[model samples]
Target: MFEGHDPYLVALSVVIAILGGYTGFGLAARIRGTPGVSHRVLLAGAAGFLAVGIWTMHFIGMLAAPIPADTVYLVLPTIISFLICALVVGISLFFVSIGEPSLRRVISSAILLGVGIASMHYVGMHGLSGNFTMEHDDSMVLLSVLVAIVAAYGGLRAFLARQDGIRLIASSIAFGVAVSGMHYTAMFGGHFVPLSGEGHHHGVSGLAASQQILSIVVAVLCFVIAAGFLLSLVPEPRRRGARDSAGETGALAPETDAAAVDVVSPQRDHAGPAAPRIVSAPLGGLGQPQRPAPVARLPLEGADGTHFIDTANVRSVRADAHYTRVHDGTRERMCPWSISEAEAQLDPSLFVRVHRSHIVAIPHVSFVRKEGDGAVIELDGPSPHRVPVSRAKIAELKARLGLARPHA
Candidate 1:
């Protein structure tokens, strides 16, 4: 029984509502940067559904259809509808910021949702052109609310599905298709019309309904296809260099059992080279192998019982420690020490720690020899092992051996 309404205004209102919802939802998704397309697609679908729902509700209410003057109505329904729609839009944004969500997200979403509801109510109120009353019919309103809730659930599920077995792109496409279907189906049942003015009021009917239905189906199909396209662009997870979850490469995966681990200081390879190698231990009596030499202890004692240590406590073995030991026609090199100790006896000019275990005798050293790996100690001593300084005695070795300090 409606008449004299502008069809253009009615259509424009719906378009604006949809745009607002779409913009709000998509903005949230972009901000979230969630790992998959499902979240983005869900947000897009939610925006569309919310826009259509709000637009239909407001437009129908604004139609001012004939009602009994005595019919009682409460403002609560409008409030509830707006609140629900706003909440749907707000949560859509929440799903986007999935990584370590900040407290600000909650606050901002609440504020945005509140504003949306208020704006919807005002827009609906202003669209009314004549005196009319809303009826108190719980069934229809409840049905609408339930449908919106279902739509929301579907949207949430679609977003969450990305975390499950579903492929990211597939989840997004599925969500989009579902949202499009739900939106169009809900819109089809809405009793909507134009705002009354110079033109007679009418909405989708006959060919218009057919066209709208076709458009909705196409839109939904497009949404699903677009979601698939977007998902294809997501990057695949990379394999970590040393980690293996399934032992796929035939190597044993490291156990994830340790809750706490130690951080050992980096060892200085001054006594020897940094390269890892295999060395056999000296054979003991009765052809038994001697235990491998223990790493030279730090804070070593010099023959003269002098203490010489690096200020930083970086331990190094002397060069003499690397000399070969021969026994029973078998010759074996001593366990290597770090560079600082190696330099103590090897480079006479550079190495001057002169004493027992103090290879660098500064006074005895006349010149220094530098090598790429480390410097070699130069001394007049016929015994090489006797000249290598220990980690603790380099300074004493230098002082006794009459060595000059190397240039910085």
Candidate 2:
């Protein structure tokens, strides 16, 4: 019934609708984690949207005036009303959900809802024939507070449930029930009189009326949808089972055993002798005839005739015409050979550029530290040294160390 109803009544209805809509919408949007919008930003926008939705609902419903004898049509419109209400409210709640719990968000939502309600009521009242001003009685205050509390609780529940799915559903249900209670309580707060004449003037049906029943259903659906969306927002924590097991083993193992394992890898490589080759006899002869004389093993050399230093072993590269000095950690350890000759003898990959002044073994890198002007590279040898990082070489150093994501 739209036309000829008191504007005050329409305003009251709008206010209630707005409050419900704001809270619902805020919770829904927040749990969804809409990017770039912070909690504060959501709250601000929801306040405006809820107010407008509420005002629009009241004004439009008033325009529809009284429906003559077509109660069935009311159901369709009322459903539409509820749908609109749910969407507006859901978005408002969503906004409130992502932000920090604050009086600001709560008060903002409440005030907007209240303003919508008040504005609608007054506007509708202006259209009424009676000379009356809507003065908020004790009932109005109680109703407003009730709406505020329920909406606030709903917003809170949505946020809590977002972290756990089960919790999210539970919170949604709780919020829906709370909202239903608030709606019924507010509807009953209205003051109206009915005519005794047959099929004459009458007031709203009892709380159990079909219209109210439908409202409850709509409210429940709103809660459910909001809860589901919120649950989707939280990310599941990752599992580190393998790493954890490895850590446990390392922690429990003796230090000497760990060291023994470390020493085994290097020794296996250099200590093993080359496999001996069997020579066949003239006639499948003599059970795999005696092996031939071993050929002289040429020295392993790097590109610049540089030899790898396994300091643990006392074997040193010969000081020959090709290379003049033995380079170690302390001195430049002069060598007559060029870089290319040294690289030819050594594994090029193992020895990499650390800085302009040094070429270090990859296995020797312990860590890379960022210093003010340059990076300080630490080596893992028995004796460690900090090498300076030239600005020109920082990018290369970082790439080699895998300290950062690849820039190119």
Candidate 3:
């Protein structure tokens, strides 16, 4: 079984395994919390990378084996095997992406993915034809499938769990080993038998080994590029940073609402940064509204570092779980503070709480629209930022924006 094992080709297969594992991890990152067409497109790209990478590795290993001169592979069966691997992987990724993270779901996805991998291996083996016939040890075959299942499960857990870079790298290495191990183990369990043939018979015509490898490499590259492009389309969450005055650890400070004061018209000088626009003042003492104060700066924090965001550039702030995401036109950053906390610090005249989890800056708000039982506030920015308004806040939000309440 190991007679024709080429060291260089085996090394190449290992490299492919590593690349596939890393790419799969990246895909998992992009898939989380993503919806609509983007998710589907990214899933497809991931599936292609994983499936093709595995399938190509397997075939390369086979090619490394020193086989009888008369042995040849059928083109049609090989293609079918590739397709089966890709389809199975694609479905597995879809299932994992859509399903909640539970023991049952994880196990089910792992089993499906393992079965696909095993099936692809055997089907590819069936493509081999010539004066020699191949047979596999049933126990070894079962063992290989089991290994695949366990590996797949581990990989899925690592991906679905917290996305730490170090953890992901470790899991990718383990997964690569599992993939390579299964192939070699299955090969170890197989033995070839001589056929009762006399003269050498020509087998089905197919591409040379070099051509096949080149094609597979090209296909994998295309899939990887497509996946990267799709991921790039999804905006990354931004981080806001503020330095502590005492030279302590930097943290995001809750925004303080600006007090009502005399309003000054905003001036936009193309040569410098844009000036903060004056927001409408809230109704004040004796029915005489005070002037709105200008918002100057915002403190933000991110995974990379801290940023003191300019208030003039802020488009909106969205609540995600316990943290708030601040969108500053181009990108968004995660703030350690909650929506309510952040709202309290922001200038009330400029930023209004539309929902328990959402706050929109008045200058960035484009329009408000009634949808279903609630309302949606749209922001003017590079991307559409729609903030949902709770029914209770609908009237207040409309009044603040000076828009007439939509009829029920």
Best by lDDT: 3
In the range 116-215, model 1's lDDT, one tens digit per residue, is 5334544333222223322323453344434444434444433322132233334434333333333333333434243456464323222212223433
The regions of model 3 sitting more than 4 angstroms off are: 200-408
lDDT of 3 at 208: 28
- For each candidate, give its TM-score against the true structure: 0.27, 0.31, 0.57
**Per-model root-mean-square deviation over C-alphas:** 26.0, 23.8, 15.1
Give model 1's TM-score versus the native structure. 0.27
Candidate 3 Cα deviation (angstroms), residue 11: 2.0
Kindly provide the TM-score of model 2 when superposed on the true structure, using C-alpha atoms.
0.31
Alpha carbon deviation, residue 254, candidate 1 (Å)? 8.8
Error (Å) of candidate 3 at residue 47 is 1.0
Q: Which model, 1 or 2, shows the larger lDDT?
A: 2
Report the lDDT tens digits of candidate 3 across residue range 219-337. Answer: 56546644653564465554332211211111122112223223222211111122233345546565534554434676565323455778777888776544557788654565655
- Model 1 ranges with Cα > 4 A deviation: 1-91, 95-138, 157-162, 166-408
Tell me the tens digit of each residue's lDDT in model 2 across 86-152: 3444444544444343557755654543333433343333333221222334675477445646554
